[model samples]
Target: MASNRPAPEAPYEPSRHPETFGYGDFRADEGPWEEWNPTEDSLQQVRGRHRVAKQRGGGLARSSTVLGVGVIAAVGAGGMASANTGKPPVSIAMPDLPSVDSLLGNGSQETPAGSGTALSALGVSSDDSAQGADDAGEALRNRIMAQAERQQGQAENKATAAADQRILAAAAQAEKVAATQAADAKEKAAAEVKKQAEAERLAKLAKQYTLPTSSYTITSTFGQAGAMWSSGYHTGLDFAAPTGTLIKAIHSGTITEAGWAGSYGYRTILTLNDGTELWFCHQSSISVKTGQKVATGEIIGRVGATGNVTGPHLHLEVHPGGQATGIDPMTWLRGKGLNP
Candidate 1:
């Protein structure tokens, strides 16, 4: 078999074939397949994509920065306006962000800071605030002082009124005491004057009166129970005395009778100016005549036992005008300050 097939060409070398290497159907008019290169339009499209990506990223960063600065400016402007206008502060809710000053670190110090306005927009001036506070304090102090003064004045008035009341009460009590003392003194003075007048009257009456007889003992009173008298009772005061004892007239009077009359052995009757009659009965003898004017203490009779008497005694009797009934001589004599 080695004769004609020439050793089979060493098993055909396909690796050396044009198709195997991809150049068997190569064409000049068509583009080369092995070497593929991009056109200018395609290259431009890729470059555009890269540029758009980079620009969009930069825009996002710049937009975020602008938003932060705007929010800060709005907040600052609102606060400043509210403070300057004396309005209530406005509250704003915002996301945390860097400060506007920090973000604008490269800016100048004199640059308009908050919302591009001046610092005067913050609030009231310092001097004005201080003056307002001082004024309020002074007004309060004045009110307190005025109230205290009014209270003190009221208290003083009350004390003065109380003192006046006490004075009036004391004065009233003193007047009452003075009136009572004056009344007592007047009563005592009246009593003393009346006593002096009575004493003078008694002294004058003593000179005009006298006792009927001297040195005689009284044996019986005017009214006595006995069977020894004609009238069945003792009718006169009996003066027991020795015979010849002098019996005198009691006062100045006229002698109405002087004689022996029955049981009345020696009797005398004297009539006074007041129509009172004095009888001297049971006498030993008579010294005065009828119708004789006699002086006080003149001898009218002498004492003796007579007039149905058991012993020698002078019987004296007193009778009112026109009445034979005799009263007690002792009682009559005492009316003129005579004890007997």
Candidate 2:
């Protein structure tokens, strides 16, 4: 059996020592010699020394030294075999070894539960990791929903404001239209009231007066320009009719004059209570004496073509306050509520 003991060290030569030392010349054959070869018993004795050193706190250093020696011996043997057979050198593979801490049990206590280990340092379990992911997704979804709700609320507020604005605008327009309609209605009411008052006044006047002649056609209006009159313009109104046409009092009055005049033939003058005078000329015959009282529409004379007159007609003149000049008879008659 092969012995596992290491070779013995050679003796140091005096000549090789750097220190000045001398020894008597010696021969290798002259020294007392003993034939020494390795044996299993000798190897067992060296291994026992290694175990003893380990107990003295030198185990780690000794183990490194032993491993290095083994590697060198293995390489030397492989080299020698290759040189002798002239074959290609073989490749050697090394096995992984445990760290010093592991081999010595320096930090080899079982990891406490829930403490950081290889797996814990990397991450949590699949279930825990999935739960964390779900929580994050739910949080994001809640944030998105909250934001959407806020935006929706803002949109609704804006829409409500717009609707209110439109309502306000419509209300303002309605108010304006109502005001205009009220004003128009008020104006119409005022105009209607004024028209009704005028009609009532005219109706009262019609009962107080009457026309002077019956069945007579108007031949001349007051203010008519003519060559036949003494004045440049006609001062009276003329009524043309047959000789038998009757002339009557225009209102309740007393006869002031009767009989012939220079241009007004068979003239008659009536004076009203207000000192207004009505003159009827060109009469065929007189129906009342002077100073006689006559009622409205009572016959005073008959139509004739008498002095200074053209065919049968009545010339009527009105004098207010008995002035020398007369006003238009047609206007006075209209004021008394007679259209003719």
Candidate 3:
């Protein structure tokens, strides 16, 4: 049923329920509206118009500030990640809303669904995301540094190896130079030794030998062809000198003959230790007797033209091994290092 007489003077009390309500059901018939003072519990049910508006505006302001801060943090992290990896920015997914109790620290029985503002309702924390980005950046920096150090080590090793190779090459070159010098020095030493040995041999030969005559001019050589010789060939060397010029014994020997024979007016024969014979002919006088031993360079005779000769000269002949045929005395003397 409906009634238009008057509405209730008090608001409905849900505690006293009759499964239905009608007009005039909560009326106090004797009370005026001005006389009534509403209980605190009743006043909380309906907000004033200004209070509601103020609460709604405050919620909007808080939501705007929190959302702005969250957005900035997220963007900053993405930028840092992109710079480090040289990649696109990473997107952060929106989190589920926070509980009203968590946001307000108040004794609200509201769940996250009933939280006042959208940003406050979010479950993710900006600090946690920013800290993760810092960790990632640190890891990336460490990796890059490790790679750089590894490359530097490899380069250093290669440079060291190249230097070692260069040192080895230089050492080998030095060794080759030293070896060449040693070879040249050895050859020079050998040549010097040979020259010294020859000098010693010549010195020994000089001690035991002498020339047949001194201060005399060679008038004729052996093997000369002329009519002055009976055989049409001179067989001995001729030394021209003043009469009675002293002639020498040449070397130590025994006199085998000391007398004139045929064309030889005064002649002497010296038989050497080795059976070679030295013949001195055309002498003015002979000082040696047959079978007499004479020392080297002993005055054996005087120069004179006693044989078939034209002037005062001594004819000298050498018979190798006492053979009648003779070799050139000049050629034989040269073999003993005598220039004349």
Ten residues in sequence with the least summed lDDT for candidate 1: 27-36
Q: Which candidate is the best by TM-score?
A: 2
lDDT pick, better of 1 and 2: 2
lDDT of 2 at 208: 70
The alpha-carbon root-mean-square deviation between model 2 and the true structure, to one decimal in Å, is: 19.7
Give the per-residue Cα lDDT of candidate 3 at 54: 24
lDDT of 2 by residue, 1-340 (tens): 7655555656533222221111234323222222234355643655334432223245436546765676677666654544344434445543223354543334542222221122221223445445555666677799999999999999999999999999999999999999999999999999999878877776787787788877889989989998988887888998999997988888888999999997888999999999999999999999999999998889999999888887899999999999999998988887776898
| Residue pairs of candidate 1 with colliding backbone atoms | none
Clashes of each: 0, 0, 2
lDDT of 3 by residue, 96-147 (tens): 3334343333343222322122232133345654555677778889999999
How displaced is residue 100 in candidate 1, in Å?
Answer: 7.8
For all predictions, the C-alpha RMSD in Å is 25.0, 19.7, 14.5
Give the TM-scores of the predictions, in the order they appear. Answer: 0.47, 0.54, 0.48
**Residue 246 of model 1, lDDT score:** 93
